[model samples]
Target: MKSLKLDYLKSLKWADYLFFALVEPRRLSGKIADAASKPLGGGIAIALCAVFSDILAASLLAVNTRFFYYKITYGFLLLSIIAFVKVLVTAGLIDMLCQFMGYPGAVRTMIVLILYSLFPQMFLLPLAYVFKVISFAPPFFYVLFSIALFVWSALIVITGISETHSVPFSKASLMFIFPYAFITLTGFLASLLALASVFGYFASI
Candidate 1:
């Protein structure tokens, strides 16, 4: 455990990683991919911090509500667990897709890139607190900013994939989006089938 902690601390160059991720994701991804011998300590740390920031930001929005304490406690735990699982699963799926496409990149590298991409979400906590204290802009500011942050992260991931796989930005975007699009379509079709079966049963009854 002590040795593991040392390794994690040594690899946790959070400032440099965050800077490169913001300005030059392609370069950052390359660095991460090259460091294959290192443990995934940096990636795991960043992912945890990012999830915590997002959950805390969301909880801050409920400050005026009676459930603020509840959200701060159990909501953070549940949401953090979900976010952690989502990061791992999504990384696995993306790496599998890359392998099937003949890229054969490491799943660990994918996880690192994905976690770095989520660095923008860390800003949400400050933004939420600022808005809560000032209310300078309209409510739509939150929606717009949220969408912008999402796009920022997506672009980072796309760029990272392009850098890792030596593909064009357009192809990289397709690679990043394909898994999610397929999942959404599958879920939609399944829901439609479920509804149809229910209606058929009601009609028979």
Candidate 2:
């Protein structure tokens, strides 16, 4: 058990993977692939990091609030809702699929890859909107950056999936597709709830 535990520890590198997620994504891919055949916590750690990053970005973007405390509190609450919903739906649904296909623990690899694949988005919004890093830059530049981040995230996701499993590309793409479909379903449900609340409020009045 000690030897196995030590090997698991060797496969896990939450900090290093997070850092290289952007600069050295190919290197990050190797780390993820290495963990595929091992029972490691790297994926779980990275997923949690992504959640924290979302909350941070939301809080930072709330800078317009006159008071720092309320800004952070409300921002974290707002982003937490979205992040948890996405995370839960993605993990649950994908894990189910993986299990169906005889890749049960592949969820660990999936979550890490998904988080790092989305690192660009999670990293960029805070820098651009919150810190005002590229505030002086032209609007077109921001748009271009967003596009690049999205494309890069997509490419990295594909590579990560390919490395983690021997599953065909078509099956692997389902991992991406399911999360997006869940997001759309979630949004639709939210809108319906909002509409119902609005109507109920007017009826009560």
Candidate 3:
């Protein structure tokens, strides 16, 4: 029983993973790649924790006068389901992009790496509360802090992709960005086309 407990404790080194993911991402990426064949429970747990932090931060920001337990509970459940789906879809998109870029990687590896990259986002919850406590804290500072966290997470994911795909960091970075860039460009062009169609119809009238 004692041995089992020790092993269990050793297995839950998520804290260390989070630390290294933020500070030593390239090294942590190698470790994550090595453990990619293991059960996905740990990676899922990390993703859930990161997602919960984001939800909790938004909940804190939404609190105006009173704190309602049921609202948070229901919101968490609904948002968690949405977030999980988004992660899976994103992993698929990223994997497809990687393959298109000639750096084919496993979907499972992408999922694990993405989840580990989110480790830095877990701090957003506490930072939100801190900003809330300080009445004079500027909104600019909060925005900067949020942007910094996102950039940090992006770098970690980029590094993981480079390590796992055995590709140049530049290529990995482009691979990491291609999906979102493509989506944004598509959306922009679609909006412009819709606007032009509307104008053409009005002109015909």
Candidate 4:
């Protein structure tokens, strides 16, 4: 009976370890560890980092175009820089957020959650362009850029989640996709309304 009790205690301890392992900073650290062990995984992480950088660049371009009225050529250059920085920052943030979530690691388990939360805007960019609502940059570039962003986010999430959760890529991919779609829809609608208000204000002027 005492042996049985000891075994149960051991099992409980293992379960606790596994549960906390899935949570945050530790999870990110685990991914880093896995990547170090596997060359292919390291390569994937690098690619994912680049993708995130591009998304950041595109987002910066959009904002600059809207508020600063920067020339297109200059805006593109700025976007490129932003994208590079974004990937670096995002990776770090993922690490931090993971730690906050009780997971520690460089693998970035929440990358999927972030991407899934943001990707829907890709669909909205074209519609916003077609409507001729805003005088900002071209719609096609934004949409294309957004696609790249989505891809990066998806990759990061997939790699991170698979490493941290020991889940298959196929399953984690779904978690990235659906939530992003919903968030994108919400953001698109909000953008449409804001654009409409801007147009109305301009016409009144």
Estimated TM-score per prediction? Answer: 0.85, 0.57, 0.78, 0.33
Let me know the TM-score candidate 1 reaches against the reference structure. 0.85
lDDT for model 4 comes to 0.48
lDDT of each: 0.78, 0.62, 0.75, 0.48
lDDT by residue (138-202, candidate 2, tens digit) is 34444565677778777667656655665666776776577678779989999999999999999
Clashing residue pairs, backbone N/CA/C < 3 A, model 1: none
Candidate 3 per-residue lDDT over residues 1-205, each given as its tens digit: 9997578678876556667787888877777667735436666777777777876666666644445465467766776677678677767888998787677568887777777777787788788778877854635445666788889989998887888888888988888787778778888999999999999999999
Output the number of the TM-score-best candidate: 1
> Quick one: best lDDT, which candidate?
1
**What is the lDDT for 10 in model 2?**
81
* Clash totals, every prediction: 0, 0, 0, 22
Ranking by lDDT: 1, 3, 2, 4
Better of 2 and 3 by lDDT: 3
Query: Every model's Cα RMSD, please?
Result: 2.6, 5.9, 3.6, 16.1
Error of 1 at 121 (Å): 0.6
Candidate 1, residues 1-205, lDDT tens digits: the string is: 9997678668765567788889999888988888756436666676677777876666656446767776667877787788778778777878888889898767788788888888887777787778767876524556666788889999999998899889899998988887688779988999999999999999999
